[model samples]
Target: SSSFFGDYPDVVAFILIVIVGIFVAMGSKASTNFNSMFTIVNMAVIVIVVGYGITFADFSLWTGTDAEGRSNFFPYGVNGMLAGAASCFFAYIGFDGLATAGEEAKS
Candidate 1:
């Protein structure tokens, strides 16, 4: 938003607050409809992007063999893969808590 709308954090915050207030005032039905519409649009965008990206993807890159005839599939080896898994686990660890946090909310 800052990139597209310039560096006006206060204005952006005000607009966001107004949008949230509108959604809240409109009640659950309107909010749910908007959420569903946004989800469909988001999925469409993802599909379009992935479809476009497939055109430029090089399947040979997965083999980790460069033009110089050197095979480096696992450059960092098993330790690197383990480290990456751990890093990703830590990054996404909070999401599960967020998903369950709403369970206790008044519906």
Candidate 2:
């Protein structure tokens, strides 16, 4: 008699992938039970970071002269802040995909 579960690499990989995918699906379903706890933990972490951050905040970095002896807090003024934000706009844009997922999540 010949067995179906022989030394086939492709078959083994496919079986493993399907098994893991099912496990992930089941785990995600179970995660809903702990969603509130996860939310509270996330909020606590944010609070702790903000609290500790203010304690060690250094206002001097915003002041002082640079190598060129510029005394302004913003060397390039508001334009520099705008340019920095513009560069990060793509990062913000990526969040739109996550936002769109909300619509599908409701179903």
Candidate 3:
């Protein structure tokens, strides 16, 4: 069946599994080096994207009124912001379980 990645979901899955298996077969040092390289590339991309966004961002929009004369900042009001913050907090709350697991680890 076709998937979001395109038609050939099985082929994509097989390719990904093979790649992951290759990484697993490699020594830990090789895996760590590849992971570090990818992390650096990811951080560079993020920095570039953020820098480009900041260059064109209009800060006035944050405090100014919208075309409909509503407050631009907190367009949905403080309650909406609070609700969004709570949702995000709950979404990431699972990460705390990792800390608990770490505490229980032998090392």
Go through the candidates in order and give each one's C-alpha lDDT: 0.78, 0.75, 0.80
Worst 10 residues of 3 by lDDT: 98-107
For model 1, the run of ten residues with the poorest summed lDDT: 98-107
Error of 2 at 24 (Å): 10
Q: After superposition, how far is residue 41 of candidate 2 from its true place, in Å?
A: 3.8
Task: Evaluate model 2: give its TM-score.
Answer: 0.46
Order candidates by TM-score, high to low: 1, 3, 2
Error of 1 at 73 (Å): 6.0
Candidate 3 per-residue lDDT, tens place, 25-71, comes to: 77556656776888899999999999999999988888988888879
Query: What does candidate 1 score on TM?
Result: 0.59
Off by over 4 Å in 3: 1-13, 65-71, 86-107
Point out where model 2 deviates above 4 Å: 1-40, 61-64, 67-69
Better of 1 and 3 by TM-score: 1
- TM-score per model over all chains: 0.59, 0.46, 0.56
